[model samples]
Target: MAAGGRASGRPAKKKGPNKGTGGQKRRSLEGKGATPPAHMRHWFKDKSRSERIAREDRGGTTGAGGRAPARRRSEDAPEYIGGRNPVLEALSAGVPATALYVAQRIDNDDRVRDAIKVATERGVALLEVTRDKLDRLTEGAVHQGVALQIPAYEYAHPDELIDLAHDAGEPPLIVALDGVTDPRNLGAIARSATAFGAHGLLIPSRRSAGVTGGAWKTSAGTLANLRVARAANLTAALREYREAGLFVVGLDGEGTTEIADVQLFTEPLVIVVGSEGRGLSRLVREHCDVVARIPMQAAAESLNAGVAAGVTLYEVARHRRR
Candidate 1:
């Protein structure tokens, strides 16, 4: 037996199975009881939600051809209006909200109470969530214990626009956007078209702006009355409109004829507005029955789609009334 060695007393303390540090690995493997719900978890924050919203505000990061890439929310994402007053006013104005989120144990003030009442009358879903969840839903807006979700806008068809005019015993006057990708411009054009007695608006399915919250806000609520239709192939749609007795008039800065002098003013007309930077595409320009320009006094370079469409629509309305 050596000095520090285990003496040969009892078989050198027979080595048994390795127990893995008091079996603490099993405790680490176990989930600390049933997991808590996401809403209840403290660490579950709405990651990058604010960044996503900022991107959407910045026109959603344009992809190839200047079209917004995915732009998820405006198409399918539910928009939320936080704050008691905003929620109540939106509900009162018939904003077509899908759901109303109420903070649990919230102070039932008049605005919140009325919002809930109107939501109930309109059959909107009422969900009572914690304040933290409401904050997350509103992206940390001053929700004041409430939020209203507005669904993505629904667009009509091009043919439906024609039918809308026909059903009203009037000729179709549609505004077709050639390449305009700004929602604010779309909203302004929509406002002008509706005001000028146009039936609806036509936009390409791609490389065009869609009806969004920005559009809705810019239109000053005119979008509610005006219908917007989307076409897969803009040139092909223009051809179809031409075949159906509608005159396709392209608005461009380089046109020889002025919009007021176009002879197709009396016909069922589709005013095609191109993008601001590049006016109209070659194919769209060739497909138009008339390429017209807005008369300008000075040597201005160009007008945006909204301004050009406004001027052109006014001229059409004036000529038609004459």
Candidate 2:
């Protein structure tokens, strides 16, 4: 046997599987750590749920360890109640709010303080976001350093409007908007409806204004007391009301009957106000039991949708009172 050579009894020792080389080859078989695709590297891929949730709570992380904000809650997506008075009044009126977002280092006026107090009392989540976030949420409107996250308004069914009147032991008196698109107009109509004893409001689900925060503020807190319903088809809804024994009265400048003289106003009535520019739609006019005009001083003049509805409601209320 040569010096420093493996000893063997009978045969020269074979190169015993090249121990060092074999180990190196085995290691080489395992490739280097490669980065995963961006989508595949989501935190949810982690087997441990707690770790995944922690990462998610921390706004999640990209493959490169970059952070991304979590998805917005459905309740906080749109429908912001901006302005100090709007936020405070919405809070005071018990409007369903998902969260109250106050700008960091706000002016801390009475309205802000009251809003915070009310939110705290109601257990509403209070989020402190940047002023820029508030501005974006309010869409460049004057937010007044505070904004409330309002969920979609829960609208009542058309039948519920009548039920409201029945509950009050009064004839069903509803104010239906044919195509009014202004939130402020809707708000003012709501105010007038509530004040003049109209039971509820009926707004078309599409191509019409809804009860937004602006409308809520314009209603002067009357929206809290009033039930506003959404109708998928305004003309069809009028027909349904007619079938239910309630008279449908549409407001237009060219109608044959004057609002004050329309006998239907005294009955279970649904006064339909048209759009600000076009007045009543042709199909809606066809559905009315009586298409009545708001008596005006000049033939050329036209009243605003809100004003016409208010004036017509006043006439109905007057007749009901007498």
* Alpha-carbon TM-score of each model against the true structure: 0.67, 0.74
User: What lDDT is obtained when candidate 2 is compared to the true structure?
Assistant: 0.84
Q: What's the residue-level lDDT of 307 in candidate 2?
A: 92
lDDT of 1 at 224: 68
What TM-score does model 1 achieve against the real structure?
0.67
Give the residue spans of candidate 2 off by over 4 A. 1-78, 298-301
Computed on alpha carbons, the lDDT of every model, listed in order, comes to 0.83, 0.84
The digit string of per-residue lDDT tens for model 1 on 186-291 reads 9789779878999999989898888865566456557767888888899998899999999889999988788767998878999899888799999999998888
Which parts of model 1 are misplaced by more than 4 Å? 1-74, 80-93, 99-148
